[model samples]
Target: MDDKKIEKRIMVPDNLDVQIDDKRITIKGPRGQISKDFSDPRFSKRISIGRSGNEISIVADSNEKKIRSLCGTIAAHARNMIGGATSGYKYKMKVFYTHFPITISVKDKEVQIRNFVGEKGARTARIIGNAEVNVGKDELEIVGVSIEDVGQTAANIEQACKITKRDRRVFQDGVYLTGKYLETGERIKG
Candidate 1:
């Protein structure tokens, strides 16, 4: 017997309360607000904002069903963006200094990883997609509309601390990803 799972897409609002100013839409939410500039007219682009009690809603739209789903996902993401911007999203990373004190810094368009366990030289880490990583003390915040970008960037940061030549059990000193915030899923870490 073939086991198949049926997936269904949820419905989203068609209308939204959009504040237009300087070619950008300021989408206000229950907790906070987010904005995006209107740049594409040729492509199927749509947005809606509405108020319900203390909560404000934002939504995205396209021509196709897949596109609509994507739009709804983006709208939901925008909601989270506003929420995170107001409440803040914090990602915790532990720096294991068993080998050398690892120093991380964001330079130009990439994150530079240096001095891993007193190594002779430092290594470099690449930040994929368009994620904004703000490093504070030992916590790194990966914030963006696309959750995948933030996750990939975080993974890049964590992977940069890996030492291949050393023993896995004894020399486990590296930057580790502790948490991630999802807009539509349960805990993702295993």
Candidate 2:
């Protein structure tokens, strides 16, 4: 019988507060608070999560590759939550067009893209969670406490400007991610 155990621990920063209740984890810091539910019905019986002092632990009874991978994924998620709550995440994007001038605007929870490829109608993308989008003449900035939300928002903008039924090599007009950084101005390598 295989009796090996898999475990991973995440260290919580002093400025951040971590709370674990059942399968839900909540982290609060200077930037903001983020709550995530890690409960999966299929793995609930095989894995357990707990906290001791400033360390969060994820343990699995089975040493199988899949279970071990899941433990590591959970630990990584917790680390991202801690970092996001403390420093926040930022995504920078630039608008590129060869012919028509592209105009972008944020209204409520939607980002409006106008004059794309000279299209009369506008295309819109939905903003996820509490991400804030700043629109400039040729650039956009997305900022949020949750990494998922910020990344998704940037993707939405890029997808909204997707070129269809056009020559791929010639007409290269779209929104592209230029850089990602922490709120404190540290560049994150993609």
Candidate 3:
């Protein structure tokens, strides 16, 4: 029974405020705040998370591979939270249609796609968390402080326009993600 400890540390940016309570971590910045619970009954007894100075540390008591990986995973998640809090995330989507013109609109935390593939009824995608959707002439933009919410919202819009019954390559009328960007207008590789 080797019980060597494994630990990972994530540096917190000066612009962000991090708070650790129990197994939950909350990060606040100029854009918004996000809180995530890292508690898992399976690993609760083996792993511990805490913040010291300006760094977050994830410590694991067991030398098992799974526990070590969990420590790294928590560190990655914390880094993402810090980045999202400081810079935020944006996803750009473009509308494509052969004949029927597609119209997108945001109404009360829901994105409505009208006349997609000449469909009579409008298709709706739910907005997650505090993400904001802006519909233009032929494009849509989704922005949020949390990467998970922004990315998921973009995926929902893309999935809603999936063509199932149509031909393999003919009916290619749908919404697609074009680019991803940070709040500072820096492009992010998709």
Candidate 4:
């Protein structure tokens, strides 16, 4: 007997729209739009992504474990893209210092960390994509339609404040991600 096809589907909400073309998927909603290239050779061979009857689907030609796994991964990415287009993503980070007060600012698509742990000069983290970075006195808010962009931007900020060659117990000065939220104002974690 021939192998049965394996597939995963994501229901498209009425308010949002999805478009697939040439190994790329674009999701658009009221909040914003996000497009991702799913053109990786490994994934392209095992899975095919398309839309049918108000749903997005990833289909695997074979029931092999690897093929099914790849289909699942593609489906998850599509779901995230749709969710992000509709609700977006938010990340909150806090600045903590023991030796010196840290100053943070956003300028020219970059986050500048100044006076961090008594540093002499400013260190900068490049902001990725269209993600917005709002630097408060001791807190930061990163928001964007793409989860990857928002998360990577947050990582950049946190990494910029990383203390090296210092005792972790005493020199515990850094920016930490405290909470995450969806654009609907629902907190994911804290």
- Index of the highest-TM-score prediction: 2
Q: In candidate 1, which residue pairs get closer than 3 Å at backbone N, Cα or C atoms, i.e. clash?
A: 16-48, 16-49, 17-49, 17-50, 99-117, 100-117, 100-118
Q: Where is the poorest 10-residue window by lDDT in model 2?
A: 1-10
On residues 37-149, what C-alpha lDDT tens digit does candidate 4 reach at each position?
A: 87877667767888898998888788888777777877888887888888989999999988788889889999999998888999999999989998888899999998889
lDDT by residue for model 1 over 76-113, one digit each (tens)?
55554454334434344656666466777888668877
Which residues of candidate 1, in runs, are more than 4 Å off? 1-7, 13-90, 182-190
The TM-scores, one per candidate, come to 0.53, 0.97, 0.95, 0.94
lDDT of each: 0.56, 0.92, 0.90, 0.87
Ranking by TM-score: 2, 3, 4, 1
Q: Please state the error at residue 66 of candidate 3 in Å.
A: 1.6
Backbone clash pairs for candidate 4 read none
The residue-by-residue lDDT of candidate 2 on 74-148, one tens digit each, is: 998998899899999999999999999999999999999999999999999999999999998899999999999
Which is superior by TM-score, 3 or 4? Answer: 3
Worst 10 residues of 3 by lDDT: 1-10
Ranking by lDDT: 2, 3, 4, 1
Better of 2 and 3 by TM-score: 2
Candidate 2 runs further than 4 Å off: none
